[model samples]
Target: MNRSSFIRRLSLVAAAGFASLFATSAALAQAAPPAAMRETMAIGDEPGRVSTEEVIIREGAFARQLVFFRSTEPVGTLVIHTSERFLYLVLGNNRALRYGIGVGREGFTWSGLVRVSRKAEWPDWTPPPEMIERQPYLPRFMAGGPGNPMGSRALYLGSTIYRIHGTNQPETIGHAVSSGCFRLANGDVIDLYSRVQTGTKVVIRHAATL
Candidate 1:
């Protein structure tokens, strides 16, 4: 073939190859797995952003950390020292994932062994009738999202109204603020949620000491 004819043929071949590759990519994208399209168990309720400002506590007891936890409890046990505002997950080696949390105020305190019966990500909030009676200004029900008081995830405790959940108020961490619930930062809750499954043991300390 002459020079110009040969160059034109090569250009045509290149264009056809590009078109084929594009089609294949589009097809693959369309056939993507449902899991891929579904939301991740990230800290934030916002799409494409896996974190929220409410989860950020730059320096405080509520900061997420791995600490030396001396306990005889089996691995995967969730231990909460309500007075200390600390929640610990027994890691089986004198270690635990310690997270700061907000405990319930005086009349709402409870201490006992409970199991995580259910878990939900970015869970909705519904104030119990008693809570509504106490705070008439509060919303009856709040949908789950960035604005939701339940920040990112919630672990329901033994079918009770109380839950271990994420909080919209970062300042509440390491304080007694909730009606009866234990509140963690969204980032910390997401981390905790990933480490525990439904039916996990939860021990809440209500005694004079941990």
Candidate 2:
């Protein structure tokens, strides 16, 4: 081939090689799990270990994940969909850290906007009077520890009795079992606690239909 034609062919070969390399890299990235997914949990000498622990309790879409989510809510806002049994922490870039949550039973479910009024690590548990009336066996007060149903951390929502807190019972993560709040595994709550702050906006959607 002439010099120019030979150079042109070489250029085509170089372009093809570059494209193949790019494609391979993209495929590898798509196949690999996120850094946290490669592991189980993030721990510490005490609670409040981190802000993004991946505890895969069951095999389904409700398992916690950081995924693309488009919404008008600002980053750092929290959106809870009770019917779907999921809570999403908005992370901007059309993405969110979605967590499987145990919401309230039918009669106990609620919906509205609330703010993170406070947060606690290994929080104490004091079953409200109303709760005790429903379950008289429950203790009126329990100090913070492993046995506390509030788990490793508690993010108090507004002035309401409800709180987004950790749970000793990880299996309850995706059920409508609570009186009316969000609950995550202890490890996951620590992770979430590390991410959120007081005054963070929390929006709860009661239903998904007309």
Candidate 3:
């Protein structure tokens, strides 16, 4: 083959190869599960499987931090403001450790005084019958782990099914997305689990009460 013809043929081959690689990458991206579905691997549930990037909370407002807060609740009290999507652990003297949270959506939101009835690390998840009725596709039971919708820890609230637990879906923080549970980032929830004990008071309030 002539030198110029050979060069032209090589260039075409390279272009075709590049195009194929690009197409493959795009297809893989499309095939990958969305952020919401990563954690469950189950159908019709919360977000995607957990990953380092997905686990790191990127929203500034949702990041856990100490903040100035005025409340009559005791130092150890957990005050959850559903409207603001914040769970505050009272630190006394007008300050508290605030955590971004995901609360129950519209019809699922509730408010009242309750206590921490129990705590568990990597707690197993059992979809309540009511929850199953609503989302029939959900698994009846799921073992806790990184991929579990319940993330790293759980503080059972009162005798109710509600809990303040860690969530695999960090993006859900600062949003109303649960059945009635209050969810924090795994790290934040672990910190919270360490600070509180069983029988600790939890005050849940809506925006109107605030």
Candidate 4:
């Protein structure tokens, strides 16, 4: 082969090698589990409607797991997985606070990165357009109070309308039953809201339960 042709063939071989390397890298990335939050609960039942008998009994089953929340130290990041109905608060030293939660409906879910931009005590309930459209009977907005859908505390997730907040409907803690927000039990939300501060990162990963 002429000098020019030999060089051209060498270039082609180099390009093919690079392509193979790129494909291998992509495959490895796919095989690795994402460094994202994982959920531990199933999606069933509705909020505010669980029977009282369950209140005492259910906690024992879930409570036996490793403790995830620590109050004595500074707050950490939080992640909520809608599909698994679980929330994870990342604590330093490889520890974390994990809690069961309720998520949105079939098509009423969202997942992305956000921060706890604001917090409230006994926050008001303002139904969003999508929420109202879903439940036409729901009021446009409900003032903050014990009876409001937003229970005792609300941790606003940055500029987005989403939130990881307390819910008046505790029965929905381990179910899929919200418009698109992450709903925690009143006690759990209160505990979390106090520990987390504004500007804490929150990642929502919605996927199948483990």
Model 3 C-alpha lDDT per residue in residues 1-210, reported as the tens digit of each score: 153244335544653565456545422233433233222111124433444222434337777788999999888999988767788999999999888887744213457899999999888888667667656777898887776777788999888877988776565566555343788878788888999999999998775521
lDDT score, residue 81, model 2?
A: 77
Q: Which of candidates 1 and 2 reaches a greater lDDT?
A: 1
CA error at residue 35 for candidate 1, angstroms: 48
lDDT of each: 0.66, 0.65, 0.68, 0.58
**Order of all candidates by lDDT, from best down to worst?**
3, 1, 2, 4
Candidate 2, residues 21-93, lDDT tens digits: the string is 6545422233433221222111111222222233334345656798888989999999987667788999998
Q: Pick by TM-score: which candidate is best? A: 3
Per residue, candidate 4 scores C-alpha lDDT tens digits across 35-90 of: 22222122211223322211211353223134544433334877665655678777
Model 2's alpha-carbon lDDT is 0.65
User: Candidate 2, residue 140: CA error in Å?
Assistant: 1.3
Stronger candidate by lDDT (2 vs 3): 3
Clashing pairs in 3: 35-48, 36-47, 36-48, 37-47, 37-48, 38-47, 38-48, 38-49, 39-48, 39-49
Q: Which ten residues in a row have the lowest lDDT in candidate 1?
A: 36-45
**Model 2 misplacement above 4 A:** 1-59, 106-108, 134-137, 178-180, 208-210
